[model samples]
Target: MPDTRQPVAARRTHCPYCALQCGTRISGTRADAVTVEPADFPVNRGRLCQKGWTAPGLLAAPDRLAAPLVRGRSGRLLTATWDSALQAAAEGLARVRDAHGADALAVFGGGGLTNEKAYLLGKFARLALGTSNIDYNGRFCMSSAAAAGNAAFGLDRGLPFPVTDLSRARTVLLAGANVAETMPPLMQHLHQARLVVVDPRRSATAHRAALHLQPAPGTDLALALGMLHVVITEGRLDTAYIGRRTTGFEALAGRAAGWWPERTEAVTGVPAADLRTAVDLLTQSGDCYVLTGRGVEQHRQGTATAAAFINLALALGLPGTPSGGYGCLTGQGNGQGGREHGQKSDQLPGYRSLSDPADRAHVARVWRVPVGRLPGPGLRAYELLDALGEEQGPRALLVMGSNPVVSAPHAARITARLAALDFLVVADFVPSDTARLADVVLPVTQWAEEEGTMTNLEGRVLRRRALLDPPPPVRSDLHVLHGIAVRLGEPPEHYPTEPRKVFEELAAASEGGRADYSGITYDRLDAGESLFWPCPATPDPHPGTPRLFLDRFAHPDGRARFADVEHDGPAEDTGAAYPVHATTGRVLTHYQSGAQTRRVPELAAVAPEAFVEVHPDTAARSGLADGDLARVVSARGGMTARVRLDPTLRPDTVFVPFHFSGDGRANLFTHPALDPLSGMPEFKVSAVRLEPLPE
Candidate 1:
């Protein structure tokens, strides 16, 4: 807990939205009466987006949950005392567990949770509930990139180098990332570099690019393969670096040989000349960076698409160099840290594999639990949701800090699944769409009312400071977890409510693993140390690793591996009935799910409702005009939104922001077909048709 005696004015903290985690300072004594100003921080450099500026609105949101609520006999959620709510929740979960065994209880977490809360939630699920079904929303965000990174580099960090290092690049190739709208402050680092953007629509980021390749949706993998093919045939490969620093070059080279530029252009709808130009821009400059975002990564072949781009970077000797590399621009506040600790189904704290004997032993010893007591790996996020209340599946679900009703792909199905659950518990600050359906809703502290750490997109571990106390009836997630664990018969000492103590246990648990954080202390962070991960405990004062793979990779042989990846298009194909491609993404004013951003008055005014972005020609062809209510219907489902015409979009593609709920919810049109390697759903591309709704 934060010291009450500490001054309440000018307390520094980080934004609650996005992985950039812009530094901010609050200048008031309470949540309802505070002002936010940008603070000097390396990542954002004192700048903030609209979401960051309006983050304080969440602390005093009109819909903020200040009391516990439990469903009564009539299925209406009524206000309940803390004791009654806890007991009801415990009994409900225990009832399901007793009837269907431990695996029948599942846990779902969020990427926005503080490191302390994320670690404890995983521990609580494994040790207290003895359940194997656990996963987080990050599976929908960057799991594909993580999978590709681990396969290629033997490690997975959003960016192995600091975000500032991007400023030194001469050319930058951005694939399916609209950073200008998604993360505005990042544009500052790319101002000096020539931008080459690839997308189906001309996004804010594309508007500023030196070149934009408007490929057909889900054809990003084909584009990348074509670029690699161009690089290989043109004899532009850095043979020396390839031979010295990586393996599997022969297999990758053989694969690339088949994806000639003309053949790729035929499949991707990108011109052969543009494919050659993209390859030239990437390889001609010795200092360049390749970055991918959700556009290319939310597909059935997402991992392969990510790997194809990595293969391009590796062949050009970009990664492991000072001014060049391949990295993923993570989406959430703690997306990097959330996955590092044990929130994923198959991972333990410190990114250790759950199936590895030695890794399991190390974490079990730190947790003070017998190694065999820890349950085995369980279902991924989509699978878990799909299995709700099914035979031999999870009968009860506990969701903390995430709203899957509005965020998950094929969301109508997910909502139905939640409704089918025997018991549901949701911990959130506001009554989000998912929380509205929970059997028990626990009011938990928000970013301004909690103290912990978050790892940013650069792999930089940052301190998240609390500026004000939570409302009297509200509790921190740590406390909620602690209370539930106690009810589950776990000793009080096992689940500490103090963030620092939980971090101490986390550090010890992560000591020898890949994402080691043993040497990082709150004192060190307070002392202004700019620490990155893999900071091991040492007798000598060790500078945290700001950059990785400078000399060697994390693999046993000290060399990166090149995956023999090839292009596999989207799971769904276009036809006469559903000819247009529909893709989903973020808007400048909204963050994930619109749970927090949609509640802000100022933000709501700027972008109050979701609208579809279609080319004028496409709209005209469909007999639709700007501001016309239209239904984008896919085979799975449909969502209705106002049409907004933009000539910059590809004539066959339309864009929708995924933040809105109700009729405007974009995920309704998305598919649950997942990337086999990463379990990431196909949120970006789907085949659909537009129908104008009668006014």
Candidate 2:
């Protein structure tokens, strides 16, 4: 008889849900039901969301792809052996490279990957495949904010400080972020600050705020400019700090001169009085913080909006101060780290620009390849996909850890272009919407069965420990990527077998660059110590930086540049055919696309169906009631979902959470127009028509 005293089954591990990256302790095995409990980590302090607690159920879900799958002659997926799958992938990639050159293949990565896996994927794409047409889902998530921050402050680390620091702030201006729903635990800190939420609708975060300014979508820049105008006119600006620590004050002040409250009020729909009050509160507070999220960054004017927001922070001397600054609230779990490690179209590891000769030389030395072997930055995501259908299109693609069919913009066009590829390979734990379209799908270990690090919104790099063994026939993503690189004849120096060694090499590649991580190692991380990046060599014994730009800015002049920005409308405006401004976002019950959370029965039960949120007045006008099926159509695409009249939403606006699949792909209706500077698609505001579905 089996020992009854022993645990009934094998131990489980943490959930691979959101950027919250909550620690979960799993105990049980496939023979029995698995149990998951929150671990007492400093980040969450044993707090677990419904998604985290129910994550283990997904491991044994019936629909999980337990083995390799490959498309057959009939265009349907068939089970295949690991060797056969890998060989096919290698041959297909090699054929594409030989026939069409390296640029003919594109690789798409995800923000959910382990740092080791992310690093190796970039290495494989550039070194092994010799392709520059590489980008990631992060291109949609945080690239615009990063571009804005890099241009204005010379650095972008999301929050640039810990989330815990928010509790120390006297006032917090949450512009466009919906933290209460996307990251509920973070709301605990917001309660301490006098919260001010700015959005087109009274979102949950806005309802909780002391002041909620409901401006029209895409008019955030005007609201920010107006606030700056009030602050400056009232002599509330931090003149001493601006005189010493910042540049471009004269140009910025001149730009704000024309954006008086009355003028901005007419443009943004925010009351002039409210704008003045917001400015007064911001200036009176000892410590104030300004934060922006996807609502502001996923737009054509994203970079400019971010710059304008930063200008307000700079005008008040908030940045580089304790518990006060301008922060971009990144969405993905590894969104901060993913961009920092050269996953973007125009960057190298260490957040270095590909055009920088010294950065190129340093990374080339680390990879042990000639500087010429590393191509300059490639096209962004939308451009990469668009190139797939062009005469000089990519013949093959290797996608890892992302579901672009559901997540990417212009879904119909992107799907058609993907189908045109000569070869497609996807490496993931489950059969995602994108994987289902691949020529070959390789099974990989999930978060609970993997070991690595993930940097959170606050730039805090924390360890993600593997607590259980992966299922049979499954391997780590890093291992799978390394094997592919080796099979493709990458240089021996770049063919490191160990994940830790690869991370060390990645750290070395980041040395003396903007997102510097040279001073860190796997050893230090394994010791339960964590810190932010730019951890350069120091004389003391500390490991990494927790807060950046405390005494000096990263710019050569040690001064932050204030961007003079003007308001711009969204790409698509609400009109007769498309009468509602459709917005997409996350929900408390689910994470992006619901690839993991949907597997959990409990989490699925909590949010079983997709629904479009419309105001009661609009729903009535459209002859629809709550729970009624509503057909929503935009210029790009259309979908049908159950309707829920939200009192908080403005009459002309609709909201949809981007967690469902099939016809419920919210991105299907999103506009593909991108920010000129960052190439981030505008997912927040799309013109859409809502009508009651036929009975």
Candidate 3:
């Protein structure tokens, strides 16, 4: 930690990283030379992980894109002036719209983008390009949890209660969330709580827990069902809470009917004794919480699995209670806000659905356009990318703040589809792997160079202050959206170059809808009080909601709905040819895609390359040894990674971190079989065969 005994000379800001959004003080005269110290924010409470400590290096990365580039007739990217670059991008999109209809033009966004940028991207796609193809990277993050939460609780806020509330919990069932490595600072709150973790490998988080249940990959649904079965068999159900505050109990009980401990043990590979012990722990524990992460949310049955966890929490009557609740730890910095806005393929601002006539009329009225002008829902992220080169797929694609080539499932296919596009435009601060493939790459301002708001995992909207100015010709995303819309012959008054101005319009657009932010403003955020959403437009201003489902649910009848979900195995089953189950997750030192973190010399040094963790028996069976290079072959593609032996993991499973590109890329082996309800790709489970390389 940097010494803070000297006088404070930096501006307070939030980390430009994960959904934790830890607070920091940034000091720098130029982009390259900067300093950071932990800020006294409630979320992390003046603590930061290695990623946050070294985040300052991103501002000064030598390869940052400071000037726009356009591909010329020589098939090479050439430096272009701002006017020429914007004109080229607009012309390309316009050409696609004119030739193949508006649906042939598409826009993709990122969850790291500020709330304002995400909002404008959706509106620009609809009003400027007049296309229905608008979705973001969050479909890859927590869409399954969002879908399941909505179906079960009538609404979705990543964590309905504040992070500080975790201190009040006595016991927690942490599933598939390796917060110890992913969000280290959050571990401070868990030290006092009795934790029960479920993972294949002995994860850092699993090691710290009181009880660790090692289930097979893609068997989280079965594990949860087994626990529920124990709760029912032991007569530990909260019949009072269920009878009073929920419905569909009979259906849920019936779904978990056949999933006794023995049956669950057979499917999940977890011992029946361990399942019974976990159930007993959860039942006996007071003020308990059940939380999940991508491990459970990034599978083919992700939605059903998430529903199972929520059902477990509701059966214990944990929602809206202090320190005890169900939440899907959102992956990206603005993922919660990203999904709440209109950037989703089938959503409108304020989390309204595009399929609803009332929601369409409400948003159309706010945008000052006829309701009929708005297009219907388009394809989800994976489906949209898969359609890129097809006849009905988009011909020209505009991307912002995302690096899909390194992050999306089936990376080889996405790269090829991007290569086949007639036009590709990317607005990013760095020359990301995806940016290197663009026809036009526009230099854009990053976190400290731009002013906007971000909603954290708790659904708390916080302001991201600008601490320094960007170099000449480097523009903000708001500037790019406005410039492009104007060149497309859209009304000038419709697009605002200023973030606050755009947020003002956005607040009005969200006034009467769910996920309401009407009462929040820059002024209120600066008022030294923590605030959450559903703050309706008012002068007196009610405090933002930090808790949900206290008295009634968001649904009309004022009762939380229950999902009668059933369990299923993974999309791809292991066979003789591919006998090992491969799973992917993030390492402690890297963020998603590693676009920014990899640029930091220190962070890269900490996690320089990707490697696979294989159990001792599996390693021996495959002839792989510690520190040996292995080529992992899956149904879709293959990647070479170093293998390390782990005795703790399930003998049939292997683990890989999905950070690096090229030979170490993990997404190359992932399956795009989506949870139909949420459109989330199954990134957690894949069947593979390993081949060791000769020394």
Best by TM-score: 1
Query: Taking the tens digit of each residue's C-alpha lDDT, what string does model 3 give over 1-695?
Result: 11223333787889999998998998866623678899989889999999899887888788888699999999899999999999999999998889999999999999998889988898999889999998889999999999999988889999988888887778889998999999999998777888999888899999899899989899999888888888888898988888888888889898888999999989988899988888788778677889899998999899999999998888888776663789889989999888888899999888888999999998899899999889999989999998996888999999997889988999999999999998999999888988999999999997877898899999999999877778887999988988889999998889898989888888888888889998988888877667899888876887999988788877788777778888778999999999999999998999999988999999999888888999988998998889999988899998889888989888889999999988789989899899999899999999999999875
TM-scores for candidates 1 onward, in order: 0.98, 0.96, 0.98
Among these predictions, the greatest lDDT belongs to 1
**Candidate 2 TM-score versus the reference:** 0.96
Which regions of candidate 1 deviate over 4 angstroms?
A: 1-7
Query: Model 3 Cα RMSD, Å?
Result: 2.5
Return whichever of 1 and 2 wins on TM-score: 1
Worst 10 residues of 1 by lDDT: 1-10
Clash total of candidate 3? 1
Q: After best superposition, candidate 1 residue 121: deviation in angstroms?
A: 0.5
* Candidate 2 positional error at 14, Å: 6.3
RMSD of 1: 1.7
Question: After best superposition, candidate 1 residue 276: deviation in angstroms?
Answer: 1.5
> What TM-score does model 3 achieve against the real structure?
0.98
Question: Please, what is the whole-model Cα lDDT of each candidate in the order they appear?
Answer: 0.91, 0.82, 0.88
Off by over 4 Å in 2: 1-15, 23-26, 491-493, 537-540
Q: Model 2, residue 584: displacement in angstroms?
A: 1.1
